[model samples]
Target: MNSDTRPLPQFAHAPLLLLIIAFLMMQPLSTDLYLASLPTLSSDFKVPLSTVQLTLSLFVIGFGSAQLVIGPLSDRYGRRPVLLWGLALYAVGSVLCGLAPSIELLILARFLQAVGCCSAVMIARAIVRDAYDPVHSVKVIARASTWLSLAPLLAPILGSYLQVAFGWRAAFAVHTLLSVSLLLLTFLRLPETNLHKNPGATNFAGLSHSFRLVLGSREFWAYALPGALSYGSIFAFISGASIVLIQVLHVPTAYFGYCFAIGVSGYLSGTLVCRRLLSRLGATATFRIGSAISLGAGTLFLAAVLAGFAHWSVMVAAMFLTLSAHGINFPIGQSGAVSPFPRQAGTAAGLMGALSMLVAFIVGSIVGATHNGTLYPLGLVVCALGLSIFAATRLLAPAEAAA
Candidate 1:
């Protein structure tokens, strides 16, 4: 088979590929795993609920900020050493989190954990770009995301079970074990992907020039911004849905996890559908279908609420469709953004992750602030986000219907 024209493999025992996917999947797990435990953490530390929420925001800020620095460092050095070191630090942070005696310390540990987890996420994407052509790279990323979606799917239920079975500290213990595994895997098999690792490009001019290359491309915004905004909506849900489901909607606390899992089921289905159709249907086609469904879902949600169809089942079903749309679109848009710069994949990924997380941070912060005991605030943001996504895509490809 010609190198670029080969059929995509749906399964691989390639140890390096498995290891990288594991680490990438784990990043989201770290973010999601703590969600169910946040209340217990607050009670344990004698802190207010909002103070505990700060850890979530703080970890996001650190995770996003660290990528800007880590990407360049990995580019200069190699993916393996960087990943190993980051995983090592992540393990240490996880231990600290498990042992943290106070809320402040727990928040600090979470930030440190983010600083480490961000490395896996950025490097995993970069390494994929290094291993395959842009198209194949995207397929691989889609497969990776398919696995990663499990974190959100299973984390809440698992976290709740663990918290009840053991304690909040068990969540961090889970973190520590996986962190160590990734660290060892990196040491054993992670390959270097910086093909153009010339010493000269390490200077200020080269770095500035990297920004120029990325910024100069309208393609970046066309692909990145829509998906970023849509992805940010997920973050909005993460920040707001706890109260909306458990408090406002009068769902039991334990059952709230099922609500979260319902959304994840949508995402998983979207991921599966996207993966199946990705190579056959182009990114734009995939996005158009997914976004339309998502927009419809969001509108249906608003209509349901207004019509007083706010039964738990109704809410769960609407959210399921909405999040499934996210699953369909997230990987497609991400593939569009990172597939362009094969040589500078680390920098490419770094830029995308950094900006995407920054957007999520802003949206998440707003959700945290505007949170009331109702779903209106969250639903409004999702609707606006859906509309914004439709506008961005239409602007990006004005001939969407024609295409």
Candidate 2:
């Protein structure tokens, strides 16, 4: 669809809004619900803490890898059918995760769940890009991000309560219901948004050419790579936060939710702030500024830990700042990277998301592997990503940032 032809939507179309919002909400739910189960899942699996951690890493890996394949397919086919299939797969995976008798089985099931979940999220971003320009797209994504951000923030608390009440398996049961309902909603209400579809037009060569164009652009990577790293940093926390909160600080199990809620507020704040600023500073400049704060926060977090003054409260505060920084960085990076590629919004969103997941996998693997009951390594890596983003933007120069 031509950008000029599609007028900006003002939330009147509840069906379309629900379509994307439903998909968007699942991510946070997945992260949050699953995260709370981490501690209990280890004992249930009869596996080492590190191995249980692998489940989270693999979920991200499956989630990221699947996006590249599904995004392009949706672009070729249609959004509704792809979303339907993916959600169904996710539901099946959820059932498997809930019923699994072994840690190995649980890990495998989580991977499957993630693989199926990838389609909705990737398509959500592409759908926005398909319908709106960079500015409007930023706002839409930021608005959606609040729902997404809350998932991880609230997930642990929710997961913790569910784990305490029933068992780790019950959490998956809840996920299964949500996934099924979304699937039914899709069959009943979903619509076509792929304005760029043409079976005969975009052959293999056209597909290759579009990807090549994305790769050859310095700005795409300039925005994408750093954004990916920022998430990598966040993954470090995702993988390690439970350890720091529950294991190290010896916080009451029930109180873990409170800490997670506090950090989540930062993300919510960033989302609200970005909406106000996207029109003024634009995605590029706003993203650069956010990157600086992320980097700065990471460094300060590292120093505090090294000085032997860092505690759970201190780390929680640092995390809040960094999460907020991510809130701002993600919407801008997402909108900016895809802004230059309107025709292939699905493909573009898929590729950017894939890069992000890959980065997160790498960082998460490192943090998970070398965990030593300290946040030093994780904090350092997050700071490094922030700096890299800042450096990349400086080198690319604002004039050429969106190249």
Candidate 3:
């Protein structure tokens, strides 16, 4: 089963591509599809907005933390079993979320759901690394990212309708059904892509060594940290958007999905551009350009809010530009992080994913705590993260060029 020695059984390219896209979509679908219900959930459970927001943070924490275990397990065992088990857990979590009568229960359910959903994300990245060479890996990841952007683009719009038509719980119900269907498909169609299995790597001693190999690499961190910060800024927006849009600027709940979609489109557009630019400019150059744009857009956003022009349209436009920068940043960062460690792809993917989600959770919690019914907090936080990305990219450039 050593991937280096044995050839993988060829599967249908289209079907496999579709499944990978589905796997990549699950995390966002779980989170974004239920977001329009945040305000409703707060009212239903008789909790404050901040308490409801804690569920989001907890989910991210669970999701990020679980990757530490899931990634290594997949590297030790195989991708298929781990993926099926993860989807099953997600299904159970979603069902519990749908049935929960208390906010506490719902928060617990969301955390479990996040933990389960993370397997899909980590495994999806691992599979790409397993199947492709380093040169083609970035292209494949960029394509997958382009498709992944659709989840954010469409999930909120669909979730909004579900919330309006049924209730906040309806999104979870739908999530449960989708997870079950994906589980069946994985069992039936998905082949074991991880031909190389490090059975000993599951032990604590081996796990620590694998982690050190990933963490000790300056190139890995140089790409991963900026990418994670860039990606986390989106979560910051997700956390603060409901209050800023619904409470402060007074956009109706039903139309909130459309507004969110506008910003997500920026990510989609950036992915498209990344796909084209990757061949010409290469990852590091493209990533640096994206970092610059994101920094500029975030600065503009903060200035707008500071200058008292905190209209919904202005915020959305600024976010759109920032997200576009994210579109370019994410795939390049992810591909770069895992590319150097071919044998330990799962561990590398897991570490990178964990750091990103952990950062997102921290930023999301900060947004929740700083909720003052204004766009100032969100703007400031995003600007700070954007600046951090710029700084990281600058620091990494010399090492990146040498590599």
Best by TM-score: 3
The TM-scores of all predictions, comma-separated, are 0.92, 0.93, 0.96
Query: lDDT per residue, candidate 1, 21-91, as tens digits?
Result: 68778666887766767666667888866787778888888888888777777777877777888888899
Instruction: State in Å the error of residue 196, model 1.
Output: 2.8
**Candidate-wise lDDT, in order:** 0.75, 0.77, 0.88
- The residue-level lDDT of candidate 3 at 25 comes to 92
Q: What's the ranking of the predictions by TM-score, best on top?
A: 3, 2, 1
- Candidate 2 wrongly placed segments (more than 4 Å): 1-14, 200-203, 397-403
Pick by lDDT: 1 or 2, better one: 2
Task: Point out the worst 10-residue segment of candidate 2 by lDDT.
Answer: 3-12
Per-residue lDDT, model 1, residue 251, is: 70
lDDT of 3 by residue, 54-124 (tens): 78899999999999999999999998899999999999999999999899999999999998899999998
| Preferred candidate (lDDT higher): 2 or 3 | 3
- Compose the digit string of candidate 2's lDDT tens values, residues 1-403: 3332232464234365456767877766776676766777777666778898878888889999887778778778877788889999999999998899898888899899888889888888877876555556777777778767767767778887887788788889998999999899888866677766846324787678778877677767767777777677677777777777888777766777778778777888888887777767877778878888887878888778778865778768887888888888887777777877777677777888899989888888888777777767767776777777667666765465555
Model 3 spans > 4 angstroms off: 1-14, 398-403
Candidate 3 has its poorest 10 consecutive residues by lDDT at 1-10
Spell out the clash pairs found in candidate 1.
266-324
